[model samples]
Target: MHRLKVQGVPLILKSIVQLLHFGYHQAMSCLFPVAIFGTLALSNVVHLPFIYRYDAILLVLLGVQYFLYRSGLETRDEIKVICLFHLIGLALELYKVHMGSWSYPEPAYTKLFGVPLYSGFMYASVASFMCQVWRRLRMDMTGWPGLASAALLGGAIYLNFFTHHFIPDVRWWLTGLVFIVFRKTWIIYRVREATYRMPLTLSFIIVGFFIWLAENISTFFNAWKYPNQHQVWHLVSFSKISSWFLLAIISVIIVAQLKYVKARRVWGD
Candidate 1:
């Protein structure tokens, strides 16, 4: 029994190392979240529930995505702009916690005022990773209205939220206002990058689609429990999702407009 127990310890450690030391390729990392979801689905046979665990693992995929970023694909200045997005997002989260825009009654852990540090790191990392992947692959960013479209899209989403009584959180509203004002400022002061135009529009489109998928899936689960938020018309909820999608696109824009993103896959550019 002692020998058996000793042998099993190494096997457990090996499994962990394999999982954590996984590959860094973009396609593999992007699908990591889906693969985790599949495992969670399969585990139902063993009478195990895996909602939170899967979320954490999905977050870990993003944690790994961070190192994949390459220097050629984007500039140092562009990276600073990307970092600014995180600063804004983290500040918004702080407001959320402060205003009770959202709250955790009894979290399993408390790393940063009811939210884990990994929550911020994973999100910020994923943003940089995803943008770099598409930028590197030369994924058709051709001929999008670029900044103008971003502003219009952001405005439309914000307006919908304002129109609905469901938009109660002042912080959320102010957050939307921040992006709007930022875009206008980018247009005015950032003369060169502001007029440069996007290499592709689908980057934003694809991100938006993913956000919709997540929101729809959450609504199905009833875990998030949005109030009276149907697909057709739910003001605050719709605004929130739309805002997320728009903001991600705006991140791309902020990075791209600063000439941060560069096509690196070519033999030599």
Candidate 2:
């Protein structure tokens, strides 16, 4: 019995070590997002001379991006992808703000069509997290759908975000399609030496929930305001999770496509 107990000690120690490694990688992957949130909170408390809070936050984020690139934390290709997400997000914010879905009450020279330019960074941060975590974890996927089908679905999901406001919300329909499309998909990731797999859909939900939590934090900092939150800051509605879930799916598809293209280029070379 003593020998058995002694042998088990290595297993326990290994488990602890792996957990620490996982946590370290996760923190590293969240650097961009942490920077964004930190800027939001800091800008709220500290006023800069002559510059509006939103504009200040944008400048800080741009500086952070430049630092990340110079530090070799983000690759050039990754930066391009992040910028693409920024454009996509900015377009959505423009439409949503126009529809009165949310309001950026703070005055800023960077405002366009009633939306702050910095607002795009919130979406770009999501792409940053996805890109960082993918590399850190050495992630890959199995049973991925065809590129055409996947892109079509992703495009549909995005269009639904706008179309829903005009027509009946087909979000649930798209959700069901997501399940069907990705039924056999699994995301394989490595932590330390061991590997694990999880359903891709499950990952979307997990990421969505976390983003919802981040949204609450952003709103608390007065980054933007929902109608209900304008009077008093409170928890964002739980139903927003569904919207984020779809957004997560879109992010994943975009990143996955980029990865696929890179891999093909490498193989061809």
Candidate 3:
């Protein structure tokens, strides 16, 4: 009947809309990593001015950032956040390279303290991807703690990475703290017509795993080398996943400052 046909039409149209929206977001999320991998592949093959490869990588990353903002794929606010991530990542890279945590193993005009400037852009790319996905997917959260709690934890986690070289590693303790603080937190993400949810801590681990995989790709392209890989490329040790998991906590805290919904519970309790 006409009434039944009219009712079915809205449902069909809604499904199509949701599917398209989901695909759009998925593609946007893939763009950053694809660009990085593509550039890395090309850098291996292309010949240019002495040390120009590293400079090229830096320019490519900067160009991508500019394009994203110019194209309105990233808002001014998101660009600012990505810039902050770049500085943070660069600082860590400086310290890590100084500590001999990883080696660039290549001469480059853009080298500073033996780390290429483009290394920072790798971290920025993560923020760019996360920001894009957040906007595209309409991400939301619940049960988030106060900003102080997250900032304090995130700050300590970052400092620990450097301090661990001199003192006891408290990463395990911090990991416990993350669970305690975020145990009730849930990340709500949309895909197609339905919204799905996952615990925030678990999401960190999952994201960390993927970043670890991405790390393999980066190292494959000789982005940086662990001590073990000085002679031959090898799979990054799985233990690094723990570090990525903790670093992801810091990333969430920073991104959440831009937009995160508190849970329906008393803050102090």
Candidate 4:
């Protein structure tokens, strides 16, 4: 027992160091989008062309995306994943904006049907952060359901976002699906040399909460406006976290597709 304790100390410290490194990279991935948005918001005081600000920000994000790949900060596979997320997000944005779910107040040369192209990056950033964290921490999962069931759940969750405006909102029903499907799912992440884990549903809530907080920051920057915010900017209602919780599930499902295909896990029964 004494010898075992002596050997465990170094392993424990190493895991802590690795966890910090993972956190740093995770933070850096999000910084790219938030920093760009914040800077452009601040630069509003400067004069620019008809399509300058929004288009310029879009171009800058594209450049950053390319640089991250070229610099090997992001893997090719991760790049593909992020791009898919961008398209998925853009499609959703187009629909939501058409439905009057949210409004992008700024005009841009890159606007398509009243949806700014840069808006896609907001969703893609979530995937980028997830991918970076997954890679850095060597994440894996236990008790994930079959792809078919997951696809059905994802479809329902997404459809609920649109259909809710007119039809009955089934989000609570889908939330039940999420709980049932992921009840046993565990997200295993490595800190350094040690592996740690939490329930996948809990991770969904935690990530959703942070995204909700980020939404507050984004709204404060006037990235988009909710109906209530049109009159006064207030803290986004916590109720939105339930919506973000659903979106986070979609993001995780997309990233998990790649992770599931590429990596075989030891935990699945």
Model 1 lDDT tens row, 1-269: 99999999998986665444333335443542343334334432333244443345335544443433352444454355446655655655555555545433323332466543333432354456554554434333333345566556554544443443465535355445445444333221112122223323334445665656654553343212233543332424545555565556555555554442233433344
Prediction 4 global C-alpha lDDT = 0.84
- Top candidate on lDDT is 2
Question: Model 2: what TM-score?
Answer: 0.97
lDDT of 3 by residue, 73-182 (tens): 78897888888988999999999999999999887889899989989878877787778887777788899898899999999999999999999999999999999999
- Model 1, global lDDT: 0.45
Model 3 residue runs over 4 Å out of place are 1-23, 49-51, 260-269
Candidate 2 Cα lDDT to native: 0.95
lDDT of each: 0.45, 0.95, 0.86, 0.84
TM-score of each: 0.45, 0.97, 0.87, 0.87
- Best prediction by TM-score: 2
266: Cα error in model 1, Å: 14
> Which residue ranges in model 4 land beyond 4 Å of their true spot?
1-19, 44-51, 264-269
Residue lDDT tens for model 4, 232-261: 899999999999999999989878977887
What shift in Å separates residue 118 of candidate 3 from its native position after superposition? 0.9
